[model samples]
Target: MSKIQFKAMVVTEINDKQFSREIVSRDVSTLPVGDILINVKYSSLNYKDALSSSGNKGVTKKYPHTPGIDAAGIVVESKNENFYPGDEVLVTGYDLGMNTSGGYGQYIQVPAAWVVKLPCNLSLKETMIYGTAGFTAALSIYKLIKGGVKPADGNILVTGATGGVGSVAVGLLHKLGYAVIAATGKPDAKEKLLKIGAKDIVLRNELDDKSGRMLLKENYAGVIDTVGGNILATAIKSTKYGGIVTCCGNVASPELLTSVYPFILRGITLYGIDSVMCPMDLRIKIWSLLANEWKLHDLEQNVEEVSLEGLNTKINLILQGKLMGRTIVNLDL
Candidate 1:
C-alpha cells in the first residue's frame, strides 16, 4: 500500500537549548513502529505537552516530535487481535507524545497495549475533552475514594481548581456529592469555579502557609492537589486526621517542602498519582466510571476547541499558566 500522508505539529531542535514547533506533513511510515495505526480525531493539551513542544528534553529527549500526550481516534489498521480497523480508541501516558509520534498528528501508530477502547457512553470528541487531565483527575479521585474518604467526611479541596485537572476534579467530586472547595490564585476565576461545581472557593494564598507550621488546623477531609510544592505541603498539613491527600501535578513547583508531622501526627495519607504506567485494569475501571457514574456535564464548560494551526497560542498560554479548563485539538480542522 502507498504510504499515507498526514499533517502534524512537529517540534524540531533548533540548538542545544532551543526548539521550534510548526505544522508539517509527515509520512505514515515516519510514525514509530507499533502494532496499531490510528486516524487521530482529537487531542488535548497538557503541561507535559507544553514542555515537549518547548524543548524540554526531559519530556522529549528527541526533537522533531509531536507533543500531545492524549488522543482519541479510530483504528485504521491493527496487528493485534485485541484491536481492528474501525475500532474507536483512546491513548494517554505511557511514552506516547514523549518519544512517539502522538495525537497531534492526523495519524498515529502506537503499541496496541497503550490503546484503550473508547468508553461506550463517551463519544470521540467527548473523550478528548476528558483527555489525560480528566483521567488524572479521575485517578486521583479514585485513589481518594479507595482511601475511604467520603462526602460526609468533610470538605474536599481541589487545588489549582481552574486548570484542566483541577477543574475536572472539582466537577467529578461535586458529581459524586463531595463538598469541593476550589482553590486558585486567579481572583477572576471564582465564577468559573462555581460553574464547574466548586461548593466554595479558597484563595491560593490561603493554601500557602507562610508561617512554617509543621501542622495547621485540621480542615479538609481530603484534598486533590494538582499543584505541588507549598500548596501540597499546606494541604497535607491542614488535612483532617486520617484524611487522604492525592498529588498528581507540580505546576507551581515540583518540590514538596514539608514536615513529617502531617503523616506522623495527623495520620494523613498522601497518595502519589501516576496516570502513566497505571495498571491496565485500574485504568479501564477509572475510564468506565468517568464514562458513567463519575461523568459530569460541567467538564465541557469553558472548553476551547482548536485545530493544529491554533495550538501554538494555547501551548504558550498553558506554559505561562494562563490557560483555563481544557483545550482540544481537532486534527481534521
Candidate 2:
C-alpha cells in the first residue's frame, strides 16, 4: 500500500507571514502511523478550518498541513479489534486536523479511540453534514435540557444563528418544540433561518447592549451563544431568572467582559461547551442522539455540497463570515 496515491489539499508556508493552499498527490505511506486507516468520503468546513488554511498559526502550528476537523468514511485497514476493513466510521475534534493530517485528504490514519462507528440510520454524508459544528450545537442543547430549561418555559435565543452551529441548533430546537429567536449579523439570512424553524429573527446588533445597566428586561428562558464578546455578555444580562445559557465559541471575541450581577441577582446558570476531548461514552451517546431523535431530516435544506477543489472558496467565505449554513466537502466528487 505504500505505492498507493491519494489526493489531498495541502497548505504550505511561503514565509513567516504568508502561505499557499493547493491540491496535491500524497502516498499512503506518508500518512501518520495509527491503528485505523480510513478512506474519507466527506469532510466539512468550519471557522477553524479557515484559520488553519490561511496560516493562522494559532490553529495550526506547522506548514504543509491538512486542515479539516471533521471526517466521515469507511475503514480501509485496522489494527484494533473493535474495527475492521469496510466498516463505516466518523471522526471529529481530537487532534485529527490540527498538527495532524486531516479529512481534507482522501485518507486519514488515526488512533482507535478517536474513531466512532457510524450510528444507525445516519449516512456518512449526513454525519459530515452535522460535523463538529452540529455536534457542538447538540452538546449545547444537551446542556440546556439537562439543566432544566424546557421548551415550554419560554423562548430560546440562538446567537450567530446563520452560522453552522447556530443554524443546526435552530433546526434541532424547533424540532424539539422550542420557540427559537434567531440572531444574526446578516440581514438576508432571515428567510433561511425562518425556513429552518426559527420563530423570530433579531439583528445581531440588536442583541448588543450599550447600556451601563447591570441587567435588562427578561425575555428568553435559555440562550445558545456561538459567538462570544458583547453578544454573550448581553445575553447573560437579559436571561430570565433561573435561566440557562450555553457558550461554545469565541470567534467574535475571546475576552468576555461582563459583571456577575446576572448570576448573583437572577440566579442564572452559565455553562461552557467544549466538544473537544469529550468523554468517549458521552460522545457515543451524543452521536446516537443525533442519529436518532435529534436527527434533522431537512438538514439538506440548509446544506451546500462542494468538492475538494471547491473547498478553497468556502474557506475564504467562512473566514469573512459570508458562508451560510453548512458546507460539506465531498472527496468522491
Candidate 3:
C-alpha cells in the first residue's frame, strides 16, 4: 500500500514548562521503524499516558509524542513472519507510550515481539477496555495465587478500589470466589463496588494508619495495592501471617515507610508487580486467563468509551484520582 495517513493525539512542549495535546494527521512513514505496523482500532487511557501527555520527563523524555500505552488492532504490514496483514493483535507495556510513540494514534509500528494475537472470546474493543490496568490487576492476582493466597485464606483487600486496576482486581478476585474488601475515598461508590463483586467497602482513610505502631490488626489474607506510600505500608503491616500483598502503582506516593516486623514477624510477602517488562510467556498466559475464566461479566458497567477528542478530560481526571474504572479510545470516532 502507499503511504498511510491517520489521526493521532500528539503532545508537544510549548515552553520551558508547558505542554499541549492536539489531534493531528500523521503519515505511517513518520512512525518509528518496526517489524510490524498495526492499524490501531482501539486504545486506552492510563496513568502513565496521562503523565506522558503532561510533559512528565520521567515518563516521556521527548515531546511531539503520542501517549497511549495500550492498543488493540489488526496487523497491516509485517516484516516478521509471525504476523500478517489483517491479523488481529494487541500490545501493552514495554517502552510503549513511554519513550516510544504509543497507541494514541490510529496506527502504531511496533516490534513483532511486543504483539500478541487477540485471544478467542475477546474483541479488539473489549481488549482495549481491559487495557494495561486490567492486565496489571490480573498479574497481581496471579502473583497472589502463586504465593499461595487462596479464597479461603481470608478477605483480599483492594486499595484504590474505584480506580482501574483496583476495580478489575476486585472483580477478578471475587469472580474466582475470593472475598474482596474494596477501599476507596468515594463513599458514594459503595453500591457500585458491591455490584462489581466487592463483599464490602472501607473508606481509604481507614487504611492510612497514623499510629506509630509497627503493626496493626492482621486482617487481610492478600492485598492488591494500586496505591503506594502509607497505604502500601499499612497493607503490609495489616496482612495476616503468611499473607501476600502485590503492589503495582505508586499514585499515593512512591515511598514505603515501614519496619521489617511485617516481613519477619508476620511472615508476610510483598510482591512488586511490573507489567511493563513482563515475559511474553507469562503475558500470553495472563491474557488467556483474562479472556477465559476470569472474564468480567459486568465489564460494560465499569467501562466508558471515548473518542480521541474526549481523552484529555479523562487524562486530567486520572491524574487527580477522580476517574473510576476504565476508558477505551475508539480510533474510528
Which residue pairs clash within candidate 3? none
Where does model 2 exceed 4 Å of error? none
Residue 241 of model 2 has an lDDT of: 96
**Whole-model alpha-carbon lDDT for candidate 2:** 0.94
Which 10-residue window of candidate 1 scores lowest in summed lDDT? 293-302
Number of clashes found in candidate 2? 0
lDDT of 2 by residue, 1-333 (tens): 446799999999999999999999999899889999999999999898899999999889988898899999999989999999999999999998888899999999999999999999999999999999999999999999999999889999999999999999999999999999999999998888999999999998898898977898999999999999999999999999999999999879998888989999999999999887989899999999999999999879889999989988898888888989999999988
* 1 versus 3: better lDDT goes to: 3
Candidate 1 regions exceeding 4 Å error are none
Question: What lDDT tens digits, residue by residue, belong to model 1 across residues 143-227?
Answer: 9989999999999999999889998899999889999999999999999889878898999998998897788999999999999
lDDT of 1 at 87: 98
The alpha-carbon RMSD values of the candidates against the true structure, listed in the order shown, are 0.9, 0.8, 0.8
Model 2: per-residue Cα lDDT at residue 127: 95
Per-residue alpha-carbon lDDT of model 3 for 69-162, expressed as tens digits? 9999999999999899999999999998898889999999998899999999899988888899999999999999999998998999999999
